[model samples]
Target: MIQQPFFTPAILLVLFAIPLALGWVPRNRFYGIRTRRALADDAAWYRINRSGAWCLIVSGLFYLAVAWVVPMSGPQDVNFRLWLLHLFAFVLPLLLGLVRIRHLSRQD
Candidate 1:
């Protein structure tokens, strides 16, 4: 049987974000938050992506925390909801990053 899938993805998310957060991931269309303004401008790329990466890192940690806190092994629906919660937590950073970019862009 597959063990604790939640930890795997959460760990991966944190692992992926740490590099980008550290400005290691070069701005590219294939990875990182590829906003037009961010991709076009060097300064914005680091600022925007770094901000997004931080969000992703936090999201990943939050998911880990929830998964650790909730010892739910009951109904399948509950498990499904937990997954839905994780999905929501995962995607929220993307939406937040977009909004944050708008504000951060103005600051520059």
Candidate 2:
């Protein structure tokens, strides 16, 4: 069995968001944006989610790359590094999404 990487948030986010970015996933309360502005209309939902998806994809890839490049030694050190990278994986995409949302909202 192929061992799955412990850190898979990046990969999972990339996989989940790509379809949404491509418009394959319809706007819904379950998956897409639940924000007032994004849920205000279908168009806004698509636009904001599309941008958010791309941001997530990019951030995920970045986290994956960084994790791959940084060599981790033993369990103790690996855990710390992994935690930091995981935090980055979550935060960077969120910041990017916020920036994208600001830009998209301005267009309206």
Candidate 3:
């Protein structure tokens, strides 16, 4: 695990803001790709996707926190496993974003 004494709390706080970050930032802007179609549809899609992304980020951080805080009397390997689990949380949202993009492209 990436061990940073101060990083944990800072990362956690930032992770918490992930939801609000996605919410406040426009979808088209956040997604890093622009669409050439109805404004409402794109906006709606962006909002939903952003929400999902935030959720993933936040969840991943939570897992990271747990792995650090919980002192399970297990082998050293468990720490690495926990970190990997944390990564998955963040990755899942990006995958969802890809799906969302495909869905949008399918539209007329």
Candidate 4:
């Protein structure tokens, strides 16, 4: 019997977690180095706030959708559901991010 690679979904899930965990910390501690040059001093906090919220929303949706989609090893095909989830996951957050970025930009 061929040994199959273990499909630990948690490992995949952690890919989603690590970034948000780091992002939740003090801005200068986790993301400060990246922002030190590009973001205006005033915009830095706004940028972090907006991005962290976006990440939380996106990652939560992604993990939930993946959990729903990955366990369809039955007679029914779930490709359409997966596709729909992917579409929403891709588009909604992008639209929200754009709107939030515009709002944040206008603040400064």
Full-model lDDT for every candidate: 0.71, 0.70, 0.50, 0.46
Query: Candidate order by lDDT, highest to lowest?
Result: 1, 2, 3, 4
Give the lDDT of residue 82 in candidate 4. Answer: 54
> Which run of 10 residues does model 4 get worst, by summed lDDT?
1-10
Global Cα RMSD, each model: 3.6, 3.5, 6.2, 7.1
TM-score of each: 0.69, 0.72, 0.38, 0.39
Q: Give the TM-score of candidate 3.
A: 0.38
Runs in model 4 deviating more than 4 A are 1-38, 46-78
Give the distance in Å from residue 44's predicted Cα in candidate 1 to where it truly belongs. 0.5
Model 1, residue 105: displacement in angstroms? Answer: 5.9
Candidate 3 colliding pairs: none
Q: Which stretches in model 3 have alpha-carbon errors above 4 Å?
A: 1-22, 29-40, 71-108
Per-residue lDDT tens digits of candidate 1, residues 39-101?
Answer: 888888898879878877887787676666653453444577666765665567546755765
Per-residue CA lDDT of model 2 for 1-108, tens digit only, reads 012143466678789889878987776779864577777788888888888788878877776666566634534454765667656655776687668767776576
Q: Predictions ranked by TM-score, top down?
A: 2, 1, 4, 3
lDDT of 1 at 91: 64
lDDT, candidate 2, at 26: 76
Best by lDDT: 1
